[model samples]
Target: MNNNSNLSSNNNKILNTIDTVMGVKEEKEINQQQEYPPLNGQKLLIYVMGTLAQIGFMTLTLWLINLGFKQLLEYNLDVRINTIIVSLFWIFFTIRSRLFSPLDNTRSRRQYDQVIRPKWAPPAFVFPIVWISIGVLRVVSSYLVWQELNQNFLALPLIIFTIHLALGDTWNTIFTVEGRYGLAVPVVIIGPLLSSFVLAYVYGQILPLAGWLIFPSCIWLMVASVLVINIWQLNQKD
Candidate 1:
């Protein structure tokens, strides 16, 4: 009788262990499924159309600006041309950020509010204000660099600056527009953060004042990188 009782107890323990293991496996599967829900066809179509439109507009704008800059170089424009260049930079960045993916839009604000941000994360209103200041810095730094380079559009520093701007816009598209939080982690670091440091260094080599202006942007990007990583981890199951 005692032997039979012990055998039954052991068997029950083994069954319970198996149940626990199976439960854990099933829960993991559910979590994985929740992490990546099935793609919505309509959403994908909209994203594709929007991306194509943005690309076409950007390409045309750059081409026309390039042609205009070349013509301007032929003429001996005075210091006033620097003002025009600054205005152009401001317009280009404004259109690139606002027209394509306005961060202050109702949908964007709603999405940002719904996210599980870190305690250190600033309010949604802070983002647009910060970016506006950064944009001003970018415009000023680029103008200074252009003046230092004798308005050479093809200078290495300017090329890197342009590439950096493109990377920042790419990050905005991925993070804000596409809502790819996990992907945006590496994109922000590898794309904008890295490029900002590089631009700062390169610009510093050319002009100290230009570098100083961009240094704040680099610091801001670092803070943004941390915020992005925290947001991704906090909302992984969302």
Candidate 2:
């Protein structure tokens, strides 16, 4: 009876100590009120899905533009040269997305005071011109891929990778920014990006010389591995 009582007392003391260290308590003591709920994952996921579908459809329509470009340009340009152009455009797009996306925000309240663009803003009408320039790069990438690859198969891989990118940033940004369990999100996203390059290497650049049909299958296996691992981590709830 005495041992049981002692153990109960010790456990209570430990819990109190932990709670004190963590600063968890009734809300009234806080100097400035921060009315925020815990990150509800289910809600975040629904928003993410909507965003992902938009990105997927946008990418597909963009790809059709590429197909048209390929018919006009012909596949005369070297694949490596095309890849270089795609890389540069991707960099520009990434920068623009970071700069402009209203969905790419954090905090519950609008901190309009913190939002500011760079000093080297072009003329008053520069925004539309800048946007159109980046749009051309995206269309050209689609066209190059369609021209270089005979089948429409290139669209499938591009869609998969873009979905992966869209999901990674959405989940990562939404949760991590809100102090939620966004474990290894960067690693998860980066692993797939690297896999895309590997797939391009094995299938697009090498398989023809190797005289093999297994490259596509192998590339898919890598993608599956990434998805499985990430899903497992998400399910583990940490």
TM-score, one value per model = 0.66, 0.38
Q: Candidate 1 clashing pairs?
A: none
Candidate 1 matches the true fold with a TM-score of 0.66
- Candidate maximizing lDDT: 1
lDDT (0 to 1) per candidate: 0.67, 0.43
Pairs of residues clashing in candidate 2 = 66-142, 66-143
Number of clashing pairs per prediction, in order? 0, 2
Query: Residue-wise lDDT of candidate 1 within 124-223, one digit each (tens)?
Result: 7566556666877888887788779876555688767756766676677567645678877887999889999999999999999999999999999999
User: Can you give the lDDT of residue 43 in candidate 2?
Assistant: 56
TM-score of 2: 0.38
Candidate 2, residues 117-174, lDDT tens digits: the string is 2343233233233334433433344334544555352355445535444543454344
